[model samples]
Target: MEIIGFIAATLTTAAFLPQVYKTWKTKDVSALSLPMLLMFFVGVFIWLIYGYYKNSPSMIVANAITLCSAFLLIYFKIKYAKTP
Candidate 1:
């Protein structure tokens, strides 16, 4: 059960990578809306806070990675926003 939970968390959380990679490789955040990214970052932050409050290591780790990935999108949105 624990292994399954870890696997689920890892896979789902790692799902943010492809989008990040695309943004990194293409430097294209045009299709990525700023408000949407902001909302996602906020949601991830809330999930991290919830995980901390609940003392769930898996949740914390997963949310932390998610937050970082979302933040990367936000960063790219801000950095290369006007380009394309």
Candidate 2:
């Protein structure tokens, strides 16, 4: 079960890397929604807290990495937002 948890965590956490990489390299956040990113960041942060309380190493590690990626996306979205 723990192995399954780690596997799930690794896959889910890794899923965010491509988006992060693309946003970093392209500096284009026009397609990313600010509200969605903000919501995701908050949800991941809450998951991290829950993980800590639950003593789930897999959840902690996954949420931590995902939280960073989500935060980066949010930053990119703001930084690269077009001026109107």
Candidate 3:
């Protein structure tokens, strides 16, 4: 069960990398919603805290990396937002 959890976490976490890379390369945030990224970052941060409390290595590692990715996306979204 733990192995399954780790595998799931790994796959889901890895899935986010492509978006981050695309955003980095394209600097195209027109399709990225600020509200969605903010919500995701908050959720991931909460999960990270919960992971620490539960001492779940898989959760901790997955959320930690995801938090970074989400944060990067949010940063990019803001940094590259077009001026009205």
- TM-score to native of every candidate shown: 0.89, 0.93, 0.92
lDDT of 3 by residue, 6-69 (tens): 9989999999999999999999999999999999999999999998999788999999999999
Q: Evaluated with lDDT, which candidate comes out highest?
A: 3
Off by over 4 Å in 2: none
**Model 3 TM-score on a 0 to 1 scale:** 0.92
**Quick one: ranking by lDDT, best first?**
3, 2, 1
Q: Candidate 2 residues 1-84, lDDT tens each? A: 678879999899888899999999999898999999898899999999999999899999999899899989998999989986
lDDT of each: 0.87, 0.92, 0.94
Rank order (by TM-score, best first): 2, 3, 1
Candidate number of the best TM-score: 2
Winner by TM-score between candidate 2 and candidate 1:
2
Query: Can you tell me which runs of candidate 1 are displaced by over 4 Å?
Result: none
Where is the poorest 10-residue window by lDDT in model 1? Answer: 1-10
Runs off by more than 4 Å, candidate 3: none
